[model samples]
Target: MTDQTPLRSGGRAARRAARAKALPDHMRPIRPGMEGGTYKPLTEAGVEAIHRAALTALEEIGLADAPETGVAYLTEAGAVQGDDGRIRFPSALVEDALARANRAVTLFARDPAHDLELSGTRVHYGTAGAAVHLVDVEDNSYRECGVQDLHDAARITDTLDNIHFLQRPMVCRDIPDNREMDLNSIYACCAGTMKHVGVSFTDPDFVANGLELLHMIAGGEDKWRERPFVSNSNCFVVPPMKFATESCRVMEECIKGGMPVLLLSAGMAGATAPSTVAGAIVQAVAECLAGLVYVDAVKPGHPTIFGTWPFGLDLRSGAMTGGSGEQALLTAGCAQMHHFYGLPGGAAGGIADAKMPDMQAGWEQMCSNVMAGLAGLNMVYEAAGMHASLLGFCHESLILGDDLIGQALRCVRGIEVNDETLALDQMREVCLGGPGHYLGTEQTLSRMETDHVYPRLGNRSSPKEWDELGKPELVRNATAKKEEILAQRSRARFDAETDRAIRARFNIHLPA
Candidate 1:
């Protein structure tokens, strides 16, 4: 055979031409709110065992340090307050709260098109953390994240298609005042993206201030109440069956203010919680169940997320190992429990124990992301941009993670088994009477975008092509994309009139 006997220029041209056409939104297969739950890491017996253990824990050991309001509400709703001040729940009360919990809740966005209907195992990925430092990929160092970094993170999140929501990912280290820090974080995230935003408050009273700011952004108190787009990611419990008094108070105010609440229970195994994975899940579930009862007692049907985040522990040194296989299984198991209770829920995943966005980070992020998505987590938090096991946040990694999540969502989407997909006719045509190859076929060209995912920074070039291009690095490409998105000069999301009013009232740190 000659060196170049065949000429497939026409086929190559046709493939390129087909890819150039934009696929419609409906046909785009990989998007937000895709159905998951195809993977079940926990067995039926195992789930039941964990559920029973959680109930027993609530009924027996109970949770200590309940705020007065929470104690009163929960006690009135059938919880027993012991002389030691530990509030214990009977299994009936837990079951009743689960019955009254909002199974299908809609997390709204300022732009209605981005609304998230969290029900069942419908999966969505987003950024979430309180990383104080920003991973300076260029300098190979870390620096304290300021208000502008938080805003820029949101803006980048707004532009990413795979990242469905913009959870407040970084703490505004520059804002010194606690109240101002809380308020400014909300303003920065809201001004950055129209996607549904999730934030936390150090003080309960700060929630009211944050609410006032949200009202101004929503045009009025009534409008903000009508469609509360923000959620309070409240860590209600301090692991091992103890309530965080201040955070519980904050959750109560958030619920009273007509805001969604995420009852986050983060337990680190082998330290604050039991070393066994199932035991860790039991503690998380019991704590969140107590939280659910607290919310239901305060206001029945209030939207709450069963945030059972159980982090893995490296027993060797007693540190969090968020990127380990155990972490993936822990998160997936938590998702199964959410499905077991039929409540809207979220779990932690897509985090990297690696300090940088290298090959290790990529594998670690994808392992948990794929597991979380496959297990049908409604909200996959910390799914992007987190590094050093949540100590650092990288803007470049965040941009690159968008591409990673797209592929994970594709796996959660699974496969279709229709007659057309069976492809008997195409097989016959190719083998019996047509060309030996299937490339450039009608089905191949049509399903290019729908059935396949294309990454923005992942290289698919041949070795020779890569050498010809001077070997572009993924981080460098991601940095360029981040710069390109931030360089855009449009801040119309926050109109000048409203922005001036906000700045005049509060110390809005984002510059014009």
Candidate 2:
């Protein structure tokens, strides 16, 4: 036993070295655009019932308060307008729009390597919200989120392998002017990440300037149109069958500018929409289908996402409960509808109602996220850094959520069983002739990186090894990691010439 000690130590060192070497993006254990949809929360009959209900809602209880432009667009597409100023869609019109919808949509990234193909059960997770406050975990306090916080969050997201895209997560509270806020929001997001981005305009007038900024970034209008990396998260409706006039106008401009639009219909369960889960989903589906018709009316086969985001409400306190099991069910059910319609769809997930990234946050974030992935939601927005039921964002939680999503994505990847994975030969060799255990086998060494996903900050150390090193708190380690990433120069920043050109053209609020 004493003579084998040196050999064992050498073998352990070799294994450690092999594990430390990084695998290419395609060879990684889990990655973006992985297929999910294995979990079915809604039966086929349930999906059909919801679809019939949504169509009935559209035909009977039509939406009201469309902007003049939207009214014209919808009317031209075979919708009938009654004296009550409500637009009602005929069943044939809705079917035509659905038929003409762009089914095979690819959300291009500034770097082609990160482009997301949104078809089938492909799943991608990323940050998204309009959180007003930033949660400071150390002091257990919240502060107003600003442009710098948004930029930092994007930079951090750029480094995380599991975060597939970056949407403007927080509002720039410092910029009081709505137009300037909208412009700066686009500028900051583009400067901080090469991944696909999503943003919303406060006013329709701001979209031209926003497109101009994107044009400069893409070198020209044609190039920006060819590969529009950013999408408009347009909440075109005010829930309960009403259109937000200004946001509808913004959606029109964005579509004409050749930008993809996420037709977001976010209805609160007990407040704005119906109280029942199925009823809330029906309202959300009706609203987004209306928006889809509106999009196809403006331009046939335009790139659009069927975004039906219905958030949960805690009845006892009358507050939003983004982290509840009901929220999980709502998102999962929505994914089923998306699948039923065969549209590229998105829904909210991984939001923590907890004030901090504690035990409650972990359970809340994981519960909905895993469900969303399994249900095969195309875009899982707000999958990280959101807290206080979408009222606050935290950098530490975002860092930790990377590991959390890595595991969630692994679940989404599911188990692949093949002859090789069955390991019949390896088991026979080990049990019959070779060593009794398979730990030191060549198969184990070769499959270590391919078959398993190891978390960057998660500790797998035993009690003895944990004691040897000072016991580290997860949040503390996250904070340290966040600082380390931010301290380094941003790999996603624009070139000096482009940065100068943008600053010269727009009122760039973030520090140079």
Candidate 3:
């Protein structure tokens, strides 16, 4: 007598909506820190040979132009200094530093949700580089990059699901003062997104200014040190066995300030480094090992990434060919070396020689992105948005790259195998007792959203449906997505008081 009619609204549609809402975090098919290393480009013997060669270079050629501070640090770590002013690392010293280095590092984000655990062969892709120009896809032109552009890049990266982190993708050309540029770059990026950021300073003196801003954002110096969200991408070496004096000093400050360091050694093949790929790798490894000794000398057990980034050269023109097949092999081989030493490492990938996001750019971006993930690169830098060998950054292309990296990470996740996944029971039921085709079975309906990744902007409709939808191009859709994301104000920004204090203390250019 008390029973009433049950409320129902659009029965089938409501049921489908319920199924979509049931997919939770653990059910996601692809996620951060998926194990890789399935593609082994280097054999065991080859890795050993390369290691020995690197040690030989360090012990023989040595590194010249080591600053006084660096000299003291390295000398304390068992390195030798000759009367000729070259600091040479003995094989024992190099191995000792390697043994003491952090095998894994957690690159944290302001929001705990984005922390990346870089250990073993776990893979993560993100944005990186210091491109001088911004690509105007509408006009097919380029202009000098400014601080606002950098903030916008971070803002877009914050919203993208597959872009794991945000490094400084472009330079603040409008800010002429180096100190102001460094501090403002940190402010603008941190304000734009809470994802872990990677920043570089032109001078060691400027690093203090940048760190001051970071300290404010993290609430205090101790809090910043406890969970350092930013890493210094220090290019410590000038390639071919020489130290960049200023950058080395900067690296020292970064190590002591409790920030993680990417001991970057970028040797352009056929130009600064050897013409052969193996020869380039050997030089990069030796240089980074020297950096390793220096870091341990400053502070033992500091978090550092073994960054052996060797860019390929176009022999015909002697210009960089960062999108070449050879570049993929070089990065993959470097990952193998990092594995050999059991150290956390990073390498460059997903760069394009094409100036815009075209068909050529698509092929070039995917090749290295897939290989870097499969080769088990702990951190894949420059994995999106870079073009023209890193001379230009395209916002539209960065949006498109979100889809590419999602697919690449799925590849890294590989295929899961179990009784449930094999689905022998479901297969038999469909073939023997049920419908000839398995379109909407119970198992299929349950697993559709969890087992597969669908692109946000990539079109997969049939020809008729595509025409009906006006044949939207990928870049156009990417442009619309970029506009849509930028239109929304970011919730992950500093409070008004902090922003005002930063702007008042420093020459911050971002509008309040």
Q: Is candidate 2 or candidate 3 better by TM-score?
A: 2
TM-score of candidate 3 against the unseen true structure: 0.96
Query: Against the unseen true structure, what C-alpha lDDT does each candidate score?
Result: 0.92, 0.94, 0.90
User: Residue-wise lDDT of candidate 1 within 1-512, one digit each (tens)?
Assistant: 45443446666776788778877778996988999999999999999999999999999999999999888899899999989889999999999888878889999999887999999999999989999999999988999999999999999999999999988889999999999999999998998898999999999988888998999999999999899999999999999899999999999899889999999999999998899899999999999999999999999998889999999999999889999999999999999999999999999999999999999999999999999999999999999999999999999999999999999998999999999999998899898978978986878777878899988789999999999999998999999999999999535268888888889989877785
Name the TM-score of candidate 1.
0.97
Question: Any runs in candidate 2 off by more than 4 Å, and if so which?
Answer: 1-15
Candidate 2 per-residue lDDT over residues 87-152, each given as its tens digit: 999989998899888776999999998999998899999999999999998999999989999999
Candidate 3: residue 201 lDDT (0-100): 92
How big is the positional error of residue 385 in model 3, measured in Å on the Cα after superposition? 0.4
Task: Please give, for residues 269-339, the per-residue lDDT of candidate 3 as tens digits.
Answer: 99989989889999999988888888889998889999999999999998888889999999999998999
TM-score of every candidate: 0.97, 0.98, 0.96
From the highest lDDT down, the ranking of the candidates is 2, 1, 3
Candidate 3 scores a C-alpha RMSD against the true structure in Å of: 3.1
Backbone clashes counted, model 2 = 0
Q: What's the distance in Å from true for residue 210, model 1?
A: 0.5
